[model samples]
Target chain A: MDMSQYYGLFISEAREHVRKIGESAVQLEADPTDRPTIDALFRSAHSLKGMAASMSFTAIADLAHKMEDLMARIRNGLPVDSSLFDLLLAGADRIGAMIDDLESGGSGRGDSAALIARMLAYSPGEQPAPPDREVVETSPPSLVPPGEPVGTTAGEEWGVPKTVRVKTDTLDSFVTTTGELITVKHRLALLAGSCREGGLHEALRDLGRHLRALHDQVMAVRLLPLSAIAERLPRMVRDLSRQLGKEVSFTMQGVDMELDRSILDLLGEPLVHILRNCIDHGIEPPPARGAAGKPAVGRLSLSVARRKDQVEIEIADDGRGMDPGAICAAAVARGVISGEKAAGLTSHEKLMLVCQPGFSTAPAVTDVSGRGVGMDVVKHTLQSLGGSLAIRSEPGRGSTFLLKVPVTIAIINVLLVVVGGMTVAVPLTAVIRTLEIRRDERGNVDGEEIFFLDGEELPLLTLGGLLNIPGGDGPGDTLAVFVAEIGGRRVGIQVDRLLGHQEVFVKPLGRPLSALPGLNGAAILGDGQIVFILDIVHAG
Target chain B: MMFRLRERRFALEVDAVAEISELLPEYPIPGAPPFLRGVVNMHGRVAAVLDLGAFLGLGTAGRGGSLVLLESPGCSLALLVEHLERMITSDDVGATRRGESRLLPVELVLADGMAGLLDVAALMDAVEKSA
Candidate 1:
């Protein structure tokens, strides 16, 4: 049977179960005798095995089979031990790695004999021979245990929107339809103009209102709680804390806040990178924490909240904060910044220097965190999604990485610009300010068009000249200058007119078109007009 | 299957045509290649409206009266042409083996004119490279 079609469902569900199992395993370590946690862990592992077996991914199924057996022994009053903890975690890690392999089109298999043997070693004696590794066959196999019923029990939470698993394609198509409806709404708004008051006008106005809400509902259908990813983090921090010999506890608040799954998925690597760095570098060792007059247990908090059109995720640590002097010194040594400039940097500026590519204060490179390429990647990832990263630190306290991400990618606020009678959409997030250019303010100095703005001169290029549209004279009598900050560099775009600002739907310029430079994607205006949104960072 | 760029005529395989429509309002994109004139709204979708003449290095004297929309898997763009010509039957066409642009080989689709058949798939690659 062709299992390719089922791969997407299998992978997503398997990953969820893996993350859930990891969280349960971490909890089991804290309280080995917690029956509920043990039961949950066993149930999750068994489900994973069944799912894997159904997919014919033997290695993952086999490992999960062993893990289920191990958890069963623990449930049967076996002596609680730390070795079991390591075995269960190792099993999880192997399965996790295999899933990663399979996701990139490899068989979800790995050499798990050693891990299986170790887990089997933890099983208590006096047990009957384990059931034959049954390759699961599903006519309609139940995910829950045989005796468990379908309905939610009394303890389960309620009042939340009931959600069902949908193929991503279905959701994408729904979003696309809603986007088209948005354009139609704009078209109707323009049509509703001529006749000020009539049944048709009122009807169109009502339709517009309802369509706006409908668009929101459709977009919200793709949103997932930030906790889906955040919940997986306690396990990561637990493992990292152990590896580093640091007594740390990860506490999260506002886990119920949600965002588009697309953003959350893209956020995975950068979040993990930051969280790992926090444990491996930011948090101090237990003895050091005690010596420094702080609690032996380190605390890292990840909080998410909605702020206007953006969602702010703050990852904070209570370990030894960043040392500005050390950072400045590192920046100097790496030639990222001059020693004199480093000396003049504020504490915040010095802390931010770590985000500069090639600037790292890590004593040496290690497998876990501190590999030199750190904040720069984090900053770049966030920036690509119309997001920004900010760092705050106190030398003796701790550091916090603040990630501000747009709420939705469907609609973006933009500044509409008219260049030689052609309109272009510029994301407002990247736009610093727009100024009118007078003849005296801009001139050619050393063969470069320079716009003198606020005591500093910046290289300026006409928007028309950039596109080779055949307009815009060198020394302008009057012009509109759009100063946008891209990757921390200022770029002045000279255009003929400013067509005001708007919130517009930006479409992804799939493969062929996206590869073309300067254009991020395209957007449809209120008047059935299409404009290209500048990928400002890539424009120059 | 028939299109015009200035006075020159071209033929597109019937399969290459997605839709033919009057020229829609287009917004110019700065920093794009010369032939990528601008973008236009196609129904509710945004399509790159390019001057096929300029793209093929044949000047159109800078005019666009109609658009011939084309689509390939994962990509869609429009050829901004002067206007659409009357449909041509295959029986009225004369096939020539004479050399054509390697990127987009053409078959003379008309017996009495220089109108040549356009290979859209190959032209997509050509446009991608130029873009």
Candidate 2:
């Protein structure tokens, strides 16, 4: 038999077995005396051992065989203890490692001799279990006659099923083809601009619309529901709760919200960090919670909702809320902020201080939350993804961190503007409002341009002046002032003209252009011209 | 050192070259020091670009040929230069003794015995008042 034919089957079977083992082990740990879960775990191990032996995978077969013996002993009413649980957990870890090795094209070799010896010691009186009980139990004298090599049809029933897996190169090729299609559309638009026939131009416009819709649909296929991420959290919470000796009931909603897979991947760590903070810091101890007239088991809720073009996720914990006064004091002591400034801050501002790097109000270092690198990292991670993290808390009530993320990563709607001779693109989401310069406007006081908007003075900047572009009317000409908020401060930008908005595919400006502070990436416009995209946050 | 005031050009050391781009004009911001050329949109974002010529005593060069974006760790601004000349590679664009010009400080003295190379970075630092 061709070994390649069985590879997929082997992998699928192995993964299913491992997943079952992991789930059941977690369940068994939760309720150590649960006979049903233990029996399920034993059956999974027994099946895996049979499958491995039939496939001639010696190491895996040996490990599964040993695990099966241990399970059998436990099932037979042997006293179970924490040490046995630890050994079982160790076995599970080893099995996971072996699976990883196999997936990576290794032979799955591992040193499980000691583990097998330990298992054998527990079942000293019994003969080693037969490799196949099904065949031995009812010697059904059928077609292939008991001892013959029934390799043809009989093996198919036990074989793993195959699934289609496309190489990344194929995906890349598809992307390149779509990009070319977009470029072709741009060329057509440019050419159509010269034609005067209204009917032909309208037809071309319709074609462009259809093509764009098709492109969007193609991209949407790559988007997966956030449930892919939400599904794993329940198990994670379950395991962490057991380890921390706390009762945490985690609830999730909006798991079906769809987002680009890339964004989902990047979001995992930050989400994990937030969840850990909730379990480790936010949730109060059982005794403390009971004394406070609350349920002994703390509740952690994670939810996702689509807001316009953005996704808002909230992770809330009914734990001891953050104390603003304590945070302010810590900030002052750490020299992050002066005592005067800390005192002057509002409660909201004080709560935000907890997200500052190296800021922690925990009394001492613990395995949980005291390392001081939690919330700040979460904020930075979200910011890097062009998202924002906001925290709202009330003392003794609870805490909630709201994360706002864009729905898609590919195309962004940007406001085009002319700075000197260069055309730049600014994401429309970042722009607050655009103002027109008037004759009576105060151009510059001591060489600084200040303009009034809504009866309040706002500083105005020129596109030419900021980028060192010459040939500007010295802030006197009719200017288009663009207001943008950066680092919690509102800044106004004056441009020579405000071009309309455009949907542009952002392409990263390689290492050569990364050093520029304000420029994030660049995109080729409909006219095949390169326009630089700005990073508003990095501008300041 | 080389500097541009309006249409006039002066020579500086070549070490001063920081960056060159178009200028970003800013509205007069209240309470801000002079020479802070408001703010400008660089690429897709807004940045604070300074006017090197106005900050330095070189007089308001106005908008000249091209904007020279310059920055040190503490100071950054855009200066209007007439136009960037051809790259001159010579063994010696000789150094000059320190001078007392308001715009050209003692540290910005150019090489005297030879045609001075453009010192875009130092001139920007001298003109920058923020740092």
DockQ of each candidate relative to the true complex: 0.37, 0.04
lDDT digits (tens) for residues B2-73 of candidate 2: 444555445544455456666544432222345654444344222345554566556655545665554344
Instruction: Give one digit per residue, the lDDT tens place, for model 2 in A1-540.
Output: 555566666666676676677667766776889998888877777766766666667788778867777787788786666556556666767877887888788987799888766555543344444444311211111222212222232235533435445544565455545655665677677888988989978888897798688768766766779876666576677667777888998888997999866678789878887887888888888998998888989999999999766799999999898988888988999988998888778886788898887887767877756664577887766665567777888777789988877776556778988766567788887788876767568557777778887787676766565555553554555767788865454667877678888777765433213344466556666665667676655454
**Candidate 2 Cα misplacement greater than 4 A, ranges:** A1-56, A61-92, A103-106, A111-163, A197-203, A338-346, A369-373, A418-422, A429-496, A512-520, A535-539, B1-131
Per-residue alpha-carbon lDDT of model 1 for A12-90, expressed as tens digits?
Answer: 8788778888888888887878999998988778788878877778899888887887777777667776777778878
Q: What is the TM-score of chain B alone in each candidate?
A: 0.87, 0.55
RMSD for each model, in Å, please?
Answer: 7.6, 11.0
Give lDDT: candidate 2, residue B40: 40
User: TM-score, B chain, candidate 1?
Assistant: 0.87
lDDT of 1: 0.77
Clashes of each: 1, 49
Candidate 1 Cα misplacement greater than 4 A, ranges:
A1-11, A49-66, A95-113, A123-163, A244-247, A284-297, A319-365, A369-374, A412-503, A510-521, A532-540, B1-24, B30-36, B47-131
